[model samples]
Target: MLDTTKYEETTISTTPACQEDPTGVNYRGNLSRTIQDQTCQAWTSQDPYQHTKTPANYPNAGLDNNYCRNLDMRFTAWCFTTNPGTRWDFCAVGYLDPKCQATPACQEDPTGVNYRGNLSQTINNHTCQAWTSQDPHEHANTPADFPNAGLDENYCRNPNIENTAWCYTTDPETRWEYCAVGYLDPRCQATPACQEDPTGVHYRGLLSRTIGDHTCQAWTSQDPNQHTKTPANYPNAGLDNNYCRNPDGVNTAWCYTTNPETRWEYCAVGYLDPRCQGSVV
Candidate 1:
């Protein structure tokens, strides 16, 4: 019975709270506050920045570009308030910085009428020797046409100098000179000298003579039994007896006795017997 009278009903539309986007305008205010707080924290954690003092802040801060227009001008001369260092003069005249200063006007030299610069008499004379294009060796008439003849060749070749001569030397023997082949000891002989003694009693065949003193005698295997005796000239006849024996089959003989002094004394060729100490038997 109720459904028979059902009529068409119109409903009013409204925004739904659950359907709103969180990333849209609803959360914008919260995002902005978070970013601001982070920025403040970062700035607070940074190191302190230093600022330079300017003339405008300190009235008594010595003369500089800020104080005058022409720092170097004679009429507007000023002194530096701060000392930069020993090398720099920081005076000011009619200006806070040096750039505003005017060029120094030329002045007549009291000592000489020809001079018309600000330089003193001593400075002017010292720097009078200006560089010239003409050959420096023209006055000396040296072998090579070297410009600036008196100057050292090394000085001319320095990178700082322009239009200088090729002063480098090519000789190997010279300390600073360059050469294709460096100098070495030319007296060094490739072949060894005779090792035999002048008396020919201790002949170490083809040995180097320069190794030891040449005064010692060269011995030969021809005398294999001759030994050294302590009694000066007596053959192996004394208590301190030493004998020369050849064990290597070489021409050289070696000492075989227990006596240290006569142990290895060299004997002549014919002295092979134990009794032939001084005599070549």
Candidate 2:
């Protein structure tokens, strides 16, 4: 049960800000009104609209004072309508013009030939050396030489047909290194264009809890439970952290439970689609 008294202590008078990202997943605004000009219900309140999304469960999702939020990591900010007839609707918030926003980078770049994003750091968190400079690690990949390669400033670029997006780093010992530039576009949040994970073996998202609300144990840890599922055991499984994954071909993604009694449990990592209305059930 939620402490409804917390709602009484809150107040929101300012209008919400416009969404900044391509998708409103980054929207941290307080837009309490719906597109139909209907007031939104408090996230903690289930009087007219019964919702599973609450501040208690999603503390970092910006659920405050009945303001609009995307606690479920959806493509847009939304809220339950106070109107008993309506369940919920997308907020009437404005989005930043595409021209004004920087182009999002792709997560995967098999070759550094097509990369144009502004990633100025290497995999070792080293700042990139300027292409214009002839410092410790000098190279001929410059904006003046290869003008079409998009070599600008110290940003990581693929001047040649390299393996992946790499840059000349500031570290003298480690002259150049590759980068793991993640996808900024929300549409690429899931596989098959944001659809459900068919087998859960390919699931790589950061869901770290079990369906029973127990915290997942680290893949490298064997304190509460000793398990063979680990990065060393399955290098292809991407088992770095406690995030849910199915390396042994289970029905869905599951994790080794932190509880000593319960060895493992399936995670409620539902359909990857941001707009999906279905659950694991």
For all candidates, the clash counts are: 23, 0
lDDT of each: 0.22, 0.63
Model 2, residue 118: distance off in Å is 13
The best candidate by TM-score is: 2
| Per-residue lDDT over 1-281 for candidate 1, one digit per residue giving the tens place of the 0 to 100 score | 56533342211112111112101212111111110011111111112222233344433433233221111111121122222221111122111112221221111211122211121101001111111222222222222443434332222121222221122322222112111110101011121111222223333222111101111222222133353322344322222312232333344343332233332433222222111222322
The C-alpha local distance difference test score for the whole of candidate 2 amounts to 0.63
Q: What is the C-alpha RMSD of each candidate to the true structure, in Å?
A: 42.5, 13.4
Candidate 1 worst ten-residue window by lDDT: 178-187
Model 1, position 277, has a per-residue lDDT of 23
- In model 2, what is the error at residue 88, expressed in angstroms? 14
Worst 10 residues of 2 by lDDT: 11-20
